[model samples]
Target chain A: MDPYPPSNELGATLGRIRGLVLTQETAQHAVDLLAQVAQETMPNASGAGVSLIHEAQRTSVGATDALVRTADDLQYDLGEGPCLTAWATRSPVMIEDTTTDQRFSRWSGAAAEAGVRSCFSVPLLRGRDSLGAMKVYSTVPGAFDEADRARLTSLSVAASALLGHVQTSETSTRISSELRESLRSRDLVGIAKGILMQREGLTEAEALAALTARARSTGIPFGQLTADIVNGHGASGRRGAP
Target chain B: MIGFPHAEEQRALINAAVVESGFTVGEVWLHYFSLSGEVDEYEVEAYLTGLMPLPSLECDLLALAVNELIDDLPPRRRAPFSDELIRSHAGSGDAE
Candidate 1:
């Protein structure tokens, strides 16, 4: 059943979703918009969520409500559900009636008890790697039909591309931040070493060893201990008795 | 034991044993990397398995190796001991 609006209206919805993907200043905003659009456009969708799968961890963001978050969290804990299957297979999985679905029996039974009678999970893929899944839930049994699944799949293609770009951008930003932190730590340690060298006339290794011994004795992180030394407080710069 | 409930606890006990034995952190790293040629977990695990029923004489060595490897980790990535196992096994041969 084609529950969505006529061709021109559906075209407008698709355009609006595409516009959101292009114009949102943050990936978080784009994902929230994606979930909102899924809930608004899909037939009988009570809520929607976006779930990202990374190395050994699964995080679902932009859930429309607590119920949606709970459903996604259940899938993350159990490691099985339409969302995970969709991500693994790089295809969509629809549960027309959660009560009768046997593939993810534990999750399905629990979801039904939570007033979710139907689900549709669409994979967000970028080439071979699956970035995540978009899941929509409905309170009515047999809520989603083939047309609803098709619409979600089409929307997910654009979403996947945008999410892939967002992930890459975020990763680059993190790497840059980490590089800057590493350089700062190095400079702090260098300054501390110079202080010890001038005060105690110690070699580089001896100065480093003295700092490390004090750090271990005081139970302070090596970086923080060095910062304390550079700031001239707490730890005395005088050489300890051998 | 494969079923040990606390991984970080085991690491802490081993680290203490190594430092108590007077081996420098750098020496431990050198010895461990010399044997394995890399700091791969599976390789370390395999090496540790070969030392099953870890002898008292070698316990500190093993502990040193593990501590040095863990010390190289980023601060946020380090998982130190946080269980009562260390207290229960203090100064006991079973800790080795």
Candidate 2:
């Protein structure tokens, strides 16, 4: 039997976490829960932060105080901080002495400014695709241990399950946006279609067909076709010139 | 603020969904990269949107944006379909 009770508690917590992530319904609700989990489980950490990379860009929103938030934001904005590197490399990043970590070529200054004495960041990825990172900060050096990293890595798995949803939801929002823009421009395209219908004697569908075909055939695009129709009418002073 | 970021996110999600759907990430990325960027934005949008067949938060956001656009448009005028009228009341709003 393991002599240390805290280590056993950490393992039990990690197992419970995996089970929760496997069944959690949505991603939005999971973020807050994970924040709470980090606070209660990580003993030495004064605060926690989560940074997620959706697409190629970085988006990190955290639940820490002003100082840790500042440090985490620095890592996110510069893309050179310990947590980001840890997440990218899918390994444990330890800053035993924040004021003295030589590996942090550029991050040392800002971290010093943030008054961070030590830092640790772990990747939230399963294999190759990184979901994001879980970072913890402390005011004292030598604050973390191997058991802490193991527990945090398990936490990252749960966090990924949550982020996977945010990412998907975000993507869904983007496509919806493109669709909306398509619809918004539809009237103009429709007017262009209407113009083509009036001028070339084509129906709505036929006008769209003509525009699409022209885009394909001429190596131009439908939006350009729509623009041409509008601009051409404006230039020609023909009927329905607007 | 919205277009590029969101588009990129959707592409990532599409890759993930495909990975979940049982294809290799490298293969998918290679195929996606090979597609010409010259394709119409609408076509590319359709392709990405098609990859994930279910409605999620993005659909809601799109609806919100559309509703906002439609709401912000000036009330319809009784004027004829003249060039001046179309140019003047063409219903422009925050798209990007």
Candidate 3:
């Protein structure tokens, strides 16, 4: 019989573990599918793009065509565009005509040159956090109306819910690095405990207590102290007392 | 649940220290996992909250993880005496 009762916390922990196993490729695939859906949702759009941004950097981008990719690239490269503004402001951004729009002059000029005359971007939001942005680009001005805007906004809400459980590249990298450092420190403590046990003829508990005592009394950090012990440069001469 | 002497008290103290040290359950679980503690993060959270029991050895390892994290916290600011401040600043130029 299982002793532990099932709870929401357990479900969340399992979800996180599942997220860790899912790779960046899976996230890319999901975004690519979302981008296609966004394009199909708006027939008048020339192309569509979905971007997953982390810390102002594009971690992944899914676009329907070369034009979509180029237009999205210009936004990140110029560091100021409708999509980025939408992500930052946690709202929808509409550029009626890139040729005449005053906002994001550099981005608009470049995007317009690349054949993007109008754009509508909506932030993919999960609760208080903005996951990224989804947008559609059109060659003609005023392509997206209030109805299209509403449709894209609802699409982003669904996309955000799906993407929220997916781990970004940056997050997985940080988690693995932290896990590695923690394992190394834990290994050192184990080796140091073995040394104390062999030399002091103490039980496992006693050895751990001794290590903790030494760390407290000498004001040495536990990891550094254990490292010294394992390196044979600590507590070698004075070992009679338990 | 496996019964261990003083398990509840130990769990309570560990939970208190974890709260005071401002470490999250995920953080504590990471360290405890590194130390070869076998319980999953969810179960560890349960143990810390006294909603469940953990084996004595695992409990000790969790305690060790919390204590180590507490030790790593930055020391609190101390008000220095006038003479101590002067001597510290006075010695900075030639101490090396």
Candidate 4:
């Protein structure tokens, strides 16, 4: 048998977590549930939250309470704390006693005053890409032991998987939007090309070249110039004959 | 302060701009690089024609990188720098 007795209800907990991940809930709801799972699974954790880092933006989701949110916000505002460190370095960061942790003294002091005496964070990662981080905080100092770390780390795997799914979905939606935009631009340019081809008696490629040249010479964007042509404005009017 | 230290992150911004600007990635790259003095118009044309055309997204990313590099240059130098880019394009006659 495994030497470490199950600290929480592993089987039931995993089943519920799997339902949360696999169900059709919003990404935020899933993230909140994951935080709840962390708080429930780790006996030392008094509160839990997930910090999402996208490009230059940081947001805290599913903080168990206001104190948990405050603890997270302090780290983001200072740009130093276990959660940010975990996201940056893609490793688990443990602050056994925030008062004595000199690495992030300002944030540590703020967090301590907020009643968070200790914390642990693990990055939600997929290969080299970091999805974000999951942080658990406690009012008692030196709250997390190795067993707690092991438990949270395992939970973070589920967190990463769900977060990765959400990331892919968002990316797809963005790409679809971009594709629509590209097509609209293409349509306008194509019509402009046709108009130029017929009016100026030039080949399709030549008409396109002319439009691009005019866009550059006038400092108007290529799409805008083509749009003007479709609307019978600007360069097409200047050309007089076309 | 505006900073894009990671190349991938910079590329992503460039890709968005390329899509939004409706400029082919190659043209944007040539314009950006010409502005930065990193590559001349002829070199960009040569690279584009001799090799398979770069995907438009990739070209935009490279162009964006050049733009960021130029932004980091001294403000007083920016005007003359853009003037040089215009001059270089005038010299090239749409070779790109």
Candidate that would win on DockQ:
3
Off by over 4 Å in 3: A1-19, A168-242, B1-4, B7-28, B31-58, B61-96
What are the RMSDs of all candidates, in order?
Answer: 19.3, 20.9, 10.9, 18.4
In the range A63-156, model 1's lDDT, one tens digit per residue, is 8888898888888788789988998888889998989999999999888888889999998899877888998999888888888888888889
Off by over 4 Å in 4: A1-25, A171-242, B1-96
Q: Native-contact fraction for each model?
A: 0.00, 0.00, 0.29, 0.00
DockQ of each model vs. true complex: 0.02, 0.02, 0.20, 0.02
Q: What TM-score would each prediction reach against the true structure?
A: 0.45, 0.47, 0.59, 0.49
lDDT of each: 0.66, 0.57, 0.82, 0.67
- What DockQ was computed for model 3? 0.20
Put down candidate 2 lDDT per residue, A84-115, tens digits, no spaces. 77767777788888778888766867787677
Worst 10 residues of 3 chain A by lDDT: A1-10
Model 3: how far is A164 from its true place, Å? Answer: 0.7
Preferred candidate (lDDT higher): 2 or 3? 3
TM-score of model 3's chain A: 0.68
Write the candidate numbers in order of decreasing lDDT: 3, 4, 1, 2
lDDT per residue as tens, model 4, A36-155: 888999878899998667643473367888899999888778878888889888999999998899989999999998899999999999877887899899999999999999999999
Residue-level error in angstroms, candidate 3, position A240: 23
| Poorest 10 consecutive residues by lDDT, candidate 1 chain A | A15-24
Query: Mind giving the per-residue lDDT tens digits that candidate 4 earns over B1-96?
Result: 112245445445555655655554444543343222234344444433433234333344345444444444455643458888989999989865
Model 1 error, position B50 (Å): 55
